[model samples]
Structure formats: structure tokens, C-alpha cells
Target: MGVVNVTQSQPVASMPEEDRKLSFREKVAATIGNMTGTMHNQIIATFLLFFYTDILEISPAYVAGLFLVARIIDAILVPVFGVFVDKVSTPWGKYVPYFAILGVPIAIFGWLTFTDFGLGANGNVIYVTATYLVYSILISIKYAPSNAVGPAITKRIDDRISMGQIGYIAIMLGALFASLAFQPLYKALGNGNDARGFSLIMGLVGLVGILVSIFQVTSLKERYINPNNSQKTPLKEMISAVFTNRSAVVLYIYVLALNLSNGIRTAIMIHYFKYFFNNEGLVVIYGAVSILPTFLGVMVSGPITRRFGIKINVLAASVVNVICMLSVMVIPDTKAGIIIFMALNAITAFFLGASTPAQGSMMPAAMDYTEWKTGKNVNGLMGSIQGFVQTLAMALAGSIAAWALHVVGYVPGVEQSSETIFGLKLLMGVLPAFVLLFTASILWFDISEEKQKQITKELAERRQQKS
Candidate 1:
């Protein structure tokens, strides 16, 4: 119970900042907070595309273009958010303030994004476009500061990796719970209307999400960030620092690919199960079967990375993903094939979850390198780059799902042709496998743990010298 009496006023300043690993309570608090903060995004990601194309009768191409536009705007604005986060200073601390300020709005906008206003087709599109753009922008703003807090909390690479592992459990758990409950919750609330169900359930979940995110302010602290460094790095300089750092570029691409893969798989998941398998309920079962293996993968990630190194674990996950995804095509379209598909999904889920920690830790490691190289602690700006990659990836993936659906001749509430069936599988299985190739760029990321150790030591010494 190494709990410090941390309040908004003196968050983390009481603790000696140098290489300060978090307490057990602090770690638990961070995990729970992260789980809550991410819930809205999970809801949107897991079901929104399906909601748009299937329930609302929006054209798949239009839906795809809409998703793409929102995320593209988000991608561009995220770095500006990073710069804004860096420029701002307050008594509560740079990162913590965002959680408190944006918490309620995130929930509100999230629920709004899921809403189906009975406006005619034109009104619905206009309303949706406006709400989604607002929600998309807020997510980028919230996550910019939210992600910056991790690096601010500590400079220890092991702690960063450990936190990432724990954080991923929260991420997957949020998704698992959302996937499991969305159908039942919506149906019960809306009396069999999917639009009504999705809207009501998201509202309830958003309320809970905001409360937990706000409570996070009291448990976590921003120890490493200099409260007094009010000098804002120009956007041009922020861009230069991030691009010039080889590891940052690699990690950005890594983030983009990983997020894009997840976006495509999830955005099109309901369509796959509902049409291709004619068993939409299998979505919940898929989430259930994925739990044990995915959690086990997360549990083993720390040990695996420590023993074999992060690069190898990430590469291995990528390779496993390709093999398992491609193997899905060979499964016969029968009841037995469902079990085989799920089993393959479980294997893929495990590796994807396993690689999360190794993947997430790279961002902060890259940030440290940037700070060392430029003598500028632009953690907020750098964290936005991570967010930017995700925005861009999701943008592309969302559009890909829609375009593929439209091209393949998908129609709601009808029997699909074999070609459409093949197209669905390709979007779900093959496209994600291809996106995982983005990891090849990571081969150039030579920032080993040993390398990080020296950078950590040198940065600390330099900070001490400056003080």
C-alpha cells in the first residue's frame, strides 16, 4: 500500500522523480482509469460501422468516406493537440487536467455518436457527420494528454513495459465487455431495435466511463514532466524532432499498422459473423473464447519480452497473425468451420494481445530518445504522434471496410453470393494480415533495452547538470 496522498495540487512532486516506478496502488489505479477512458472508443469501434451500414441504411461507400474524413481531420489535429498540451501549464499538472476536463464530454459525445435521430436520411447524415467529427476530435485531444501521462509518470523502461501490459488488459477487457453486452443491452433497452439498443447502452456505459476517468486524477501523478517548462516548441520543431528520431518514425508506423489491423477486423466483424456465418450471436462467443488465450498472452508478454527481447516478440506476433489469418480461407463453410474459425481467431487474438505491451512500450522508449537527442521533453507532442498514427490507421481501415463491402455487393437482410462471402473473409482475414506487414519497418528500430538503459542514464545526468 505505497499510496501517496496525491491530490490535484501536488501530483507526483512529493516523490523523487528519477526513475520512479509506480506503486501497486498506482498501477492498479492507472489500469482501471485506462479501462474506463477507453470504453467509449471501444463502443464506437466495435459497433459503429455496423450500426451505420446495417441499421441506418447508409450507403457503405458514404459511411466509408464519412469515417475516413473524420479520422483524417483527427489525424491532422492530434499533433496540434500535442503541441497545445505541451504549451499549457496549470496547478493541477499538464496531463492530469485533461482527464478531469474532458471526461464528461467524452462520455456525452460518445453516446451522441451512437444516437439515431429520426431525422430523414439527409438530416441523419448531417447530424451523424457533425457528431462524429466532434467525437473524433475530442478523442484525439483526450488521448494526447492521457498518453502523455505515462511518460510523465516515470522514465523506467521496465515500468513502461509493465504498465503497457497491464493497460492492454484493460483495453481488451473493455472490448470484451462491450462485445459481450452490446447485443443484449441494446435489445433489452430498445425492444429489438438495434439503433435504440446501441444508443441507450452507450449512454449508460459512457456515464460509468466518465466517473472512472475523473477519479484517475487522484491516483496517478505526473512526476517526470517539468511543471515550470512553459516554453512551447513550435509545430515545425515538434515535427522535426519526431521525424528525425529514427525510432519514433518506426514506432509511428508500428502504431499505425497495429491500429489499422484492429480497426478493419473490428469494424467489419459483425458483418462477417452475421452474413458469412449466418450466426451473428457468435460475436459474443468469439469474445468469450478469446479471453483465456488473449489474457494468457498478455500475462506472458513481460516474460517473453524480457527473455527474448521486444523486437522478436512483436515480429513473432506479426508472423503468427499472417499464418492464422490466411489459414481461415481453407476452412469449409459449415458448422464445423465455425469452431475452426474461432480456434484460429483465438490463436490470432493471443498473439495480438501478447504483442501489445511490446508494441506500446516502444512509443515511450522512442520519446526518451527524442528527449535525449533534442534536449527537449516534448512528451505531449510525441504522444500526439502516437495518437496521430492511430487516427490515420483507423481512417484507412474504416474506409477499407466500407469500400470492400460496397464492392463485394453486400446487401442487408438477404442471402449473399459466394463472391460476397469471399470478399467478407478477405476483408476480415487477408487485409489485416497484410497490414501487419507494417512491422517490417520496425526492423530498423534498433533501440534495444540495453540502448534504452544508456539513454536513460545519460538523460538523467544531463537533467541533473542542467538543474
Candidate 2:
């Protein structure tokens, strides 16, 4: 018994040397799964409003309402689902089960959202509201759980960071496809009718997304702590833990700022393309340029996290973003000038992509901090608050964008006023830059990598003793 205890005590000299480094196949599978999941965001953030307003002819005010109301509903669902994820046990894993159950339905509803059926403006609004709300809820089901899985898959901070980078790469690829391909596909299929063409493209992409998620669930393994045997705490206790847990609160606030900034940029994209650029087709060009940096940044995220720490990386990215965004105010909006500005924005996105992995690493650290301090793994509720805050940010961003457009005298189907164009430019550039700067302040987190390893080592010993 003494020898066994000693053997267990020192499983390895240091972190077991990661005997099961992710193989190429596993990395590819993980990337595909992550990319599929991100289709939800890219589609929502980049395309949905434009699809409704310009293609379906829905009112901008109504579009804003749909975004706000649907997110509210989805936010309500997050805590409930988090509780469900905590209590449930499955063959695949707690988080993977959601992908199995919700992935198909999410895809189906997404398909319905794009189909349109040639409904008039009012009818289209009603159809879109119902389908989009359902889609949003379904997305919450998969997203909340999958996010928790990141920590569950690995105890090593470095491995988790690597996984996060792979996931970000996948997400960037999805964004790239959505931005670059959707418009061209719509043009080919709809023959100049954007509404029908875009719908068809979304339906096809939805099918692909479902398959990717399914494959992800089947291929991946959850090898770290099992939620089933982990310590359980009540919701109130978990909520309290989040406040006391400094890392958790900082991460929550940081995510809120990032989402708010990104959401503002997404909400105003159509207006910028149509009014400021004087061409709707420019949406594709901007989208491609903006997303390209994500691909470039993902390659270096692991090394950056290793060298500079997560908070510093995030701060550096935010600084770069602010500088690039402020340039828009100085640079004239000529074709060449716009392209140059877009290129600079893309560079900012590269750093933004690098920061995402850092953010992901922080969540698990927060979970560990809670467990280490309270002896309870309240990942589900912790994840719920994270989701809720992020969704709230999105809702606020959408409302702000809608109100900004209204204040600037934006009127659909008419040539936009110069004031409206100015508003769009601000929304595209300055607003997001300022929001990111503020969020960077919130990322004054204290969870260094070495400290995180100590927590994990202690937690593993505790688990072994109980066993």
C-alpha cells in the first residue's frame, strides 16, 4: 500500500510527458469539428441581418428585435442546459452527447432559416423569428457543453492551448468558407436573386456542418476528469464561486468585451458594404480579407502562449487592433485605400485569433481554481455564466448597431445618406476598437501557467486518494 501510494503520488517527474500527443488524424478531426461549430457564429454574425433586411426585406427594427429576443431566450436556456449537462452521463461523454443530440436539429433549423419559400416581408419575418430562435437555442445546447469539453480533454495547460489553437484554426476556416464561398455560391445558384441563392448555400453548408459535428463526437475522447464522479455543488454556491474566483470573473468580463466588439463589427458589416463601399458585393471581399488573418495567427498561438502568457498576448492583440481601427478615420475610403485598411484589419485579426486560444486556456484555469478552492467542479454553471455574459454582449451590440443606424437616418431601399455612411464607418472601425481596448483592461488575470500546473497536480492527487 505504501509503494502504491508513492507510485501514484509521482505519476511522472513532470506532467507525464504527454504520452498521447494528438496525432495528425486526431488534429484533423478536431479541427473539422471545431470548424463546423463555428459555422453558427460566422453565419449569424456576418450574414443573418443582411439576409433578412436586403434579401427577405424585413425591417431593420424587427431584425434588431429578433437578435435581442432570441439571445434572451437562449441565455435563459444556458443555465438550465448547464445543469442538465452536469447531471447527465453518456457513452460519448457529457459534452459530446449534446453534439450527438443537437447537431442534426441545429442544421435542420438552419436550413429552414435560409429556404425562405418566397414569403412576403411580414411572413418572412415571422418565419425567420421562429426558426432563428429555435436555431439559437439548439446552438446553445451544443456550444455550452462543447466549451466545457476543452478542459475535460486534457489536464496539461500546454495541450489544452494546442487544442484551442487547432479549434481556432477550424473556426477560421469555417469563417473563411462562409465569407468567401457563400456569396459566390449564391450568385451562381440564385442567378442574381440573392435571397434564394443565399438560402440554398446555407442549406448545403448546414448539411456539411451536421456531418462534421457527428464525426467530431465519434472520433474524440474525453480523457481527463469525468464530470460523473467529480464533486457537485449547488447553483448558488457555484455562482458565488465565480465572483470569488478572480480568474473566472476576469475571463467572463474579457469574453464579454471581445464579443461586444466583434458583435458590433458583425452587425454593421452589411451597412458598411452596401452604403460606405457603394456595393453589396464588397461584403465578400471584406469578409475574406478580415478572416484571413485568423488563419495566419492560429499557427503561432501555442508558441506565443508559451512565451508571453495569455493576458499579455491578449493585451498586445487589442493594442494592435485599436491602432489599425483608428487608421480608418485618417485614410480616405477609395478602392485602394479601403483595400489597405482592410489589409491592416486582417493583420489585427491574426493577433485576435492568437488571443482566442489564450482565452480558452483561462476558462479551464478558472474551473481548476474553483475546484481547488471549493473542492467542487462546477464547470457547468461556470460555463453557463460565461455563455450568458457572451450572449448578453451580443444582444447589446446588436441593439447598439440598430440604434446607431436609426440615429444616422438609415432608410432601407433608398440610397443611404452621407451621415448613415459615416455611422457605418464608425461602427466598422472605431466602435469595435474602443470596445476591445476596454476589454483588454479586464484581462488583468493572475493565472500563470506554472500556477495552473500546481493546481492540476494537487487536484489529481486528491482524486487518487478518494479512489
Candidate 3:
């Protein structure tokens, strides 16, 4: 609870002006942009694997192999995208212009990924793989800048937390829409043909994606620009700098574990509902039950972060989430048991949703810490590595889930054996519980709010001296 004393440091010879306050209109636009973007991404992560394996009858092993390869490529390209972002200077500034140029192509390819091209096994493989890779590349191109945009829009930690809350609302909205609507929409729209339904659904998502990019580029303004970003570092130097960031390293590891757990759980959820519950439609029911508590968690996250720093809040939420998940693992799968489990799931989802704002808030603070230590603000590089680690974790989860199902002799759309049922349950409940526990244990983040305050003060002093 110590107050950060910026005035103790030597005063600037002259202070010019304070950062401009973000308007409500801009905030709304930014929030919508994040909402739509996250919604589109959520659909891909949540439904695409099922679509590939179940609807299209593609070999899960083949799809899994492709997922692993694409992630490897993503790992390589993410940092390269980081370096590219750092080096480029445009009239719209470094981050915003990419949204304008790349948005359409990203949307189109994202749509194409879910479409049925009437391609046979070989043709389908090529079409799906090629389109997915291109969409991933475009997402990588935009993710760094899009993430960096939050910190750029505001420097005050409280303001950033408020923005984070808004963003989480967007996250929940996106997730809720995807979770509740995907099955029904596909059923109603596709009229029993899942491929066509998925295509139609994605076409709608694609249009929304384009509109989001337009809104973001047009309505948002970047107010905080790092003075150190003026000179571009070589890729080797950038990589070296990113690794040297201790807090960034910690955040990356934490994010990887978090996303990995979610990825595996998400990839297996439909199967669990279909086989274990004998009610495939229960997925939507669970989503419906989750909406209220999850929204409450997101709404309260900002105040909680303001009161007890983001690190503590995130850690506490993670621990609570683990406990809830453990309860889920032990609960029976009967009617009453399922109701209790869904209630617990709702509570756990709340904490998970609550932690998200803190998660987003941590990175920019880490970037500030990195700049304070290394005298270079590599937001693009930081964003890239964070994105890389997260994408890689999720990709790995999908690959592992696919392979795990294959190992257990899973046959889609058929009655599974007890062994396969146990495996699915393990994936859904037990393994993710362990992963969440591990995540909670390792989240010993050292970057406190007072430290961030000090960093912000020092960076401002440096910028004034430079000017």
C-alpha cells in the first residue's frame, strides 16, 4: 500500500502537457472492435476442430498433424511479425494501419476455412490447411498491434483496468455468443448439413470482423508512443531483448499454461457432452447457465484489480477456479450431479473471466518494466512473443487432444467404449484441473502497481528530456 513517489525524483525542467483523456465514443468503438475480433477468434478455436473431424469426416489424426505444423510456422512467424511491426512507420502510426489493410483478407480466409469446397480427402486437406494457415498469419499480423493498442489508448493503470473490464465484457459477449449460438445457428441455418451451416455462420462472423477493423482503425487513437521505439533493432537484438524481460517471460509462461488448459478443455467439450452426458445439446444449456455469473465476474474485475493489484487478483481467481474444477471432477454425471457441476462450472468460469482483464493488464505493465530495465520499449516484440506462446499453447492443446482421442480409439458419431469415455472425462475435468493448479502456483508476478507507477514516471521523464 505504499504510495509511489514520482516527485522525489528530479523534476523536469519544464512539463509541456498531460496525456489526453479518451472519450466515451472512442472507448465504445475500441470495446466493440475487441468484442467482434474475439468473437470471430472464439468460433475458430471452439468449433473448427469438431467441424473438421465430425462434419467433414476428415481424419482427426491428419487434422491434428496439420494443427501442430501450423503452430510451428506460427511460432516462427510471430516474432518476425514483431520485428516487422517495430521497423515500419506509417501515417496512421505503427499499429492501426495494419487493421485497415489486412482486415478484409483475414475475414475472407477465415470464412473460407469453415466452408465446404466439395473437395475430396486430398482436396479438402489442401483447401482447409492452406486457408487456415493464411488466416492464422493474418491474425498474427494484427494481434501484436491490436494487443498493444490497449496500453497505447491509455497510460493510467486505473483507466487501463476500466478499459480491460470493457474488453472482458467483449470477451464474455463473444464467448457467450459462440457457446450458446453455434449449435443452434448451425442446426437452423445449415438444415442438417453442418458444413454449409458452419460456412454461413462464418460468413456472418467475417462481415462482423471487417466492420470491427474499420471501427478500430477509425475511432481509436494511439496516445502513448514509446520514445525508444524510434530506432528499429535487428531481429536478433529484438529476440534477445524479449527474453531478457523477466516479467514478460513470466507472463508468457503463465499465459501459455492458461491457454493450453482452456484449449484442451474446449477441444474436448463437445465430445464430452455428446458421449458422456448423452446430450449433445447440453453444451448450449451449460453456456446459458454460465452467462450471468461470468458477466458478474467480468464487471467486478476492475474494482478488484484497483483494490488489490492485478497479480493478487489473478492468482486468487486461479486458485478458486482450480477448486471449482476439482469439485467438477469428483461430481457424478447424474441429472442432479450435472446440475451441481454446471453451477460449479459457472462459478469457475466467473473467476476465469475475471482473470482475463488482469491478464491483458499484465503485459503492458511488463513492457513498461522491460523498457525501464533495457531502455528499449519493444511492445511489438512483446506482443508477438505473447501471441506466439499463446497460439502455440492452444495449437499444442488441439494436437494433443486429437492424438489422445486417436490413441483411445475414439470413433466420432458412434457409441464410445468405457475407456474412451474415461479419456474424454479426464481431458474435460482432471487434466485441466492439474493445469489450472500449476498455473496458480507459478503466478508469482513481481511487477506490482507501485513499480508500474514508478516506471511510468521515469519513462515520462525520459521522454521530456528527449523532447
Query: Which pairs of residues collide in model 1?
Result: 186-197
* Local accuracy of candidate 3 as per-residue lDDT tens digits, 1-467: 11223446764442433345567767666566566667767787678889888867789999878876777787888877777777676777777777777777888988898898888878888888888889877877667777666666666677667677788788777777886777799789999888888899889988988887788788877766753463655666666677877777778878887888878887888898888878878877877887787778888888787788788888887788767756655667688877887888888878867777777788888877766666665788788878878777877788778987898779998999999888787778778778766665345568788888777778778777666
- Least accurate 10 contiguous residues by lDDT in model 1: 1-10
Clashing pairs in 3: none
* Candidate 2 structure quality by residue, lDDT tens digits, 1-467: 01122223454233442235665555555556667767767777778888888778889999888877877788788878876676666866766666668878888888888777877766887898888899888887665676677666567777777777887877777766766676688889999877778778878888887777778777777655556544345666656766788878877877888889888887887777777666777766766676657866877898888798877887888788788877766667578876786788788878988888777778888887776776656677777778788778977898888898888788987887777777778878888888877776545688788778777777766665655
Q: RMSD per prediction, one decimal?
A: 6.7, 5.0, 4.6
lDDT for each residue of candidate 1 in 217-243, tens digit (9 for 90 to 100): 888887666664536556677667778
Models 1 onward score TM values of 0.82, 0.82, 0.84
- Clashes (N, CA, C under 3 Å) per candidate: 1, 0, 0
Better of 1 and 2 by TM-score: 1
Identify the leading candidate in terms of lDDT.
Answer: 1
Q: Which ten residues in a row have the lowest lDDT in candidate 2?
A: 1-10
Each model's lDDT: 0.78, 0.74, 0.76
Task: Output candidate 1 Cα RMSD.
Answer: 6.7
Instruction: Please tell me which model should have the higher TM-score, number 2 or number 3.
Output: 3
How should the candidates be ordered by lDDT, best one leading? 1, 3, 2
